[model samples]
Target: MYQIIVGIDEDEAHAKLCAEEVVGMPGDGSEKHVTLIHSFTDNPSGASATQLAPVREASDVLDEAGIDYDVTESSGDPAEAIIDAADDVDADLIVIGGRKRSPAGKALFGSVTQTVILNAGRPVMVTGVPEDA
Candidate 1:
């Protein structure tokens, strides 16, 4: 079974993009699974994973593509939560949204994406590419 840990933030567009990538994954078997992780730095309302808009949107994309996923809500550092989920699932790949680069080629990544890219033991795929690229 192929396992993927998708790090989804508050942005629905990013989450959709991440899920679109899932649809393009190499495998077609029902064995392919995705672990959706949404990290909340602070929660005043005490929302669950299923309550988040981004997670729900991502789930919609996954559902349309017939991909299976499990939601995991975490509190604390997003990178840490994603990494831990990856470790827990022994994920084959990690997916996260990334920042687009400036025309001068200066690209800034979100801290969570940067951290995951630098520290994850497994492969990390950052979604969103510069238009020119």
Candidate 2:
């Protein structure tokens, strides 16, 4: 069975899209296990409702697909948390979402997607937010 880790945050639409892509992959749900990860920089309990939205959205998508999965909440840098989770689970693949960003914006605020893509030992699948999304 392939173990997959999906990184999610406040962008619910992008997160759900990532989950959907994984579900659409060639394989029965039983043969692919999914882990949805949400990383928080501070106390998870202090997170506002908005911060948890993506996790909920992604969970709903996986649930509707009848995909076996679990949710993980970690406190630290988002990219590091996601990579650590993958290592803990021995994930075969990582699915993450990205959004269009200006070069200046990317340079100023390093991208978690980019970090994971570079550091993840396993294959990484990246999904992008639709232009209108």
Candidate 3:
């Protein structure tokens, strides 16, 4: 049995699509448990509240899929929190939504996805956001 963990940013549309992909995966749903995770970066200026929208959207997706999952919120660097959660759960796989960025943009602001890909012990599945979403 595999424990699948999906990282959701709280974007309802993006999260809905991600949950659909998870549920629609070619496997027995009974053999897997999906866990949804959300991380908030510690912004001294209090930027964490901005994450509610995406997290809510992600939760809606799980609800619609009828996949019982756990949603957690944490305050810290996003990469660290996500990695910690994956480790705590001993997840077999991780799914995350990413926004594509140019090389310059990536260099200027390193992506959490990239960091997780490098450091996470489990497989990571990254989904890209559609232009319209």
Candidate 4:
């Protein structure tokens, strides 16, 4: 079986974009499985990973594609969480969404996507973050 891990933030459009990419990956849906990971800074409302808006949006796409998927949650650093989740699942590829940013802008604000790409120690697929994100 081929395994994929997708990192989802609060952006529904980006999540859906990544999910669609996974849907188009080479394989019959039966041979693939996706894991959606989300790291929350804080959960004042205490929502499960599956309950998050972006995750649910991604899940919907996976469902329609006849792909199998699971949800994973973390409470701290997003890049670390995504990498750890990928490692835990022994994922074949790690997926994430990112907006185009200048090198200076990324250096100033820091990018979880950049960090994951640099440190994942495996293949990473980046999806274009939508304007709404």
Best by lDDT: 4
Candidate with best TM-score: 4
TM-score of each: 0.87, 0.90, 0.82, 0.95
CA lDDT of each prediction against the hidden true structure: 0.87, 0.87, 0.74, 0.93
- TM-score quality measure for candidate 4: 0.95
Q: Which candidate model has the greater lDDT, 1 or 3?
A: 1
Q: Cα deviation of 124 in candidate 1 (Å)?
A: 0.5
Which window of ten consecutive residues has the lowest lDDT sum in model 4? 124-133
For model 2, the stretches where C-alpha displacement exceeds 4 angstroms are 43-51
- C-alpha RMSD of each candidate structure in angstroms: 3.3, 2.3, 3.0, 1.3
Q: Tens digits of per-residue lDDT for model 2 on 23-89?
A: 8999887888998888877673687433587888888888898889988877779999899999999
How well is each residue in 51-101 modelled by candidate 1, as lDDT tens digits? 989899999988987888999988999999999999998999999988655
Query: Which segments of candidate 1 are over 4 A away from where they belong?
Result: 101-110, 129-133
Output the better candidate (1/4) by TM-score: 4
Q: Which model is ahead, 2 or 4, in terms of lDDT?
A: 4
Candidate 1 vs candidate 2: the TM-score winner is: 2
- Per-residue lDDT, model 1, residue 46, is 88
The CA lDDT at 44 in model 2 is 36
For model 2, give the 10-residue run with minimal summed lDDT. 42-51
